[model samples]
Target: MAKYEALGLIETFGLVFVLEAADAMCKAADVELIGYANVASGYISVLVQGDVGACKTAVEAGVAAVKAMEGGNLYSSIVIPRPHQDLGKIIKRYSITNLVTE
Candidate 1:
């Protein structure tokens, strides 16, 4: 079983912002970059998994980094502590076409 107890999601617009958020999230805490979902119309979500505290820290860092960008616009940031087991099914349903890649 995965040791991760929390999941962090940082949603932002544009590939540039996504990259920035992901970089910040990874650098700020000991988390694993699971994957991302591109929700369409340039909206992307960067997902990370780790301990609750680490996820919180990473999300905060990711949000701060996005806000620091000149034209950065952070749509939302979420921390799901002890996400449901079925969450994986929902995530997997997101089309691969919607996977964010730059």
Candidate 2:
């Protein structure tokens, strides 16, 4: 979404599985691991960006990776193609750059 042609997200419980999913998604497709969010309830949402097809593939790979884990409990998965430009403004408020750096 935002400036990206497509955006994929996988939100699941547990940090380990979500991280693994993110890694697998990146390796499985031509996509970028943009960022991730962790909520107080131990839910982690991993975000990836690329073309529509790539984003779909990456999201499936990510969800599958999480499903392969014994305790993985995937909550939601989404793929947004050609999201509105204004979405970037909201996403920037999250400071995804800082998340990647540290």
Candidate 3:
């Protein structure tokens, strides 16, 4: 399966509330959430990994779903990162592991 990396910017209703919803949406999409960073203003940046088609579809679906919610706003950009290299290495490096399981 081909791997894809995506960067999503979510403008949430509220930090905590929307973050919870984002988490749920990511889980439902089967996205391998690599890492996230809170921007200076009020944007949450996310990095995720998945199959090319699945990731694109999921990202669009997730954004639409969020927009449908009572108070949610989100946008995303899918990036290949490099000319001919996959972003798997970066994804793996930033992936959150379950310490107990590890």
Candidate 4:
């Protein structure tokens, strides 16, 4: 079994909105913040990992938090359960493991 059963992502336009989402996600579920990525043009993607149900709940909470922001601009959001191990290669730089070791 994988260490984490699911991965959640939330993309938004404002840093403050994303931070709000991240805070909500962590508080609403037993998830780990894997880190975030800036995709330029004021877009950022926040990542979290946990069990399937927790990931889904966390993503929902994050989306709601962003929507609650006065001028929040949410780009997209997703929850991937049982993702392929190889997917890590693509997002390795944003993983918490990378942050810890570096």
Best by lDDT: 4
In the range 1-102, model 4's lDDT, one tens digit per residue, is 269899999999979988999999999999999989888999999999999999999999999999988888899999999999988876788876776764
User: Which candidate leads in TM-score?
Assistant: 4
Worst 10 residues of 1 by lDDT: 91-100
RMSD of model 3 against the true structure = 4.6
Q: List the residue pairs that clash in candidate 3.
A: none
lDDT of 4: 0.91
- What does candidate 3's lDDT look like per residue over 1-102, in tens digits? 144434433334346634654565476576666565455476655555565554555556556666666666554444332223554554444445621253
All candidates: TM-score: 0.87, 0.88, 0.56, 0.91
Q: Estimate the overall C-alpha local distance difference test score of candidate 2.
A: 0.84
Ranking by lDDT: 4, 1, 2, 3
* CA lDDT, every model vs. true structure: 0.88, 0.84, 0.51, 0.91
Task: At residue 44, give the lDDT of candidate 1.
Answer: 92
Model 1 / residue 26 / CA error / Å: 0.3
Query: In model 1, where do residues sit more than 4 Å from their true spots?
Result: 93-102
Point out the higher-scoring one by TM-score: 3 or 4.
4
Candidate 3, residue 9: lDDT: 30
Residue 52's lDDT within candidate 2 is: 94
